[model samples]
Target: MARRGHHVGVNDTDPPLPAGTPLPPDELGHRLTEVFDLVGPLYRRALRKVEQGEAVEGASVGVRSVLDLLCRKGDLTVPQLSRIQALSRQFVQRMVNDAAAHGWVEVLPNPAHQRSSLIRITEEGRTLIATVLDREHSLNREVGGDLTDAEVRACVRVLREMLRTFDHVDVDD
Candidate 1:
């Protein structure tokens, strides 16, 4: 059996290892594996929620944005909704169609325009968002029970900053 010798004791009195101690890249890879093992399942479970119909807020950001705009702004035409949601006309149309099927939104005649139509949220759609928000908030509270609201906000800010990477920026060696 191979004897392992990397067990550094957790005491401050012990002198630090010499600068020549080589760190195998495999050890760094193992650390990354452990981190992904811990975090990957969280994202997978969230996906599973979508598969199980628990993610009624819609599957894409485009869809959710359209609903949010409709719910917040009352009613709007296709072009109006598309512009407000910053989505392409085609994408907005697709979302509106799916939403219509889910009873989340409906199209009504636009008196202001001869050919265009108005899109508005249905009662069920409003209820669905309220339910989704309540469930999301409850889950957040349950998972982060030990964290204060300020800590949560700070974490969000830090995470957003970390994610604000630019594709145009090049790392030069």
Candidate 2:
């Protein structure tokens, strides 16, 4: 899906849109939605390719990131994870539940707060996450090898700025 479809002569030759004439608010929002719609399948396909020989189940980029965080940071509450991910607490909980069902993580009693429980990664989770990380690193290297470091850094900087303001966007609903 991210295969950078050939626009024939337009790939690198097309001129940038003129002076903010590309997308107005509504159009930008719609294009952003289209980006996600296009990216999800492509992203998943890449992950699938990475896990091709392995028997990894239910591995998505988001799910793998959750596991990676748990692996690196010990345990975290759902809200903590949600905040870190910039996703809804409910959505993160659903992911946690799914991982728990697969024995990749477990919900434990939290002395810090009775209402919030800590989720810890299991040994199985670590093993699977190890494989995921290996493939992820390899994929990143392969994909990023084509781009200059400056290009990658610019991409990261732009996305980070976008993320910082993501929740501030006004919704018409």
Clashing pairs in 2: none
Candidate 2: global Cα-lDDT?
A: 0.73
Clash pairs, candidate 1, are none
Q: Quantify all predictions' global Cα lDDT against the true fold.
A: 0.65, 0.73
Across residues 1-173, which tens digit of lDDT does each residue of candidate 1 receive?
A: 22223223222244445665753555434433444565589767864654454445554545566777888889988878766544567778898888888899999998999788999899988887666656656766668458877877966764454335332343221
Top-scoring candidate (lDDT): 2
Model 2, span 61-140: residue lDDT tens: 55676788999999999988987877778778888987898899999999999999999999999988998877677877
**TM-score list, all predictions:** 0.48, 0.63
lDDT score for residue 81 of model 1:
77
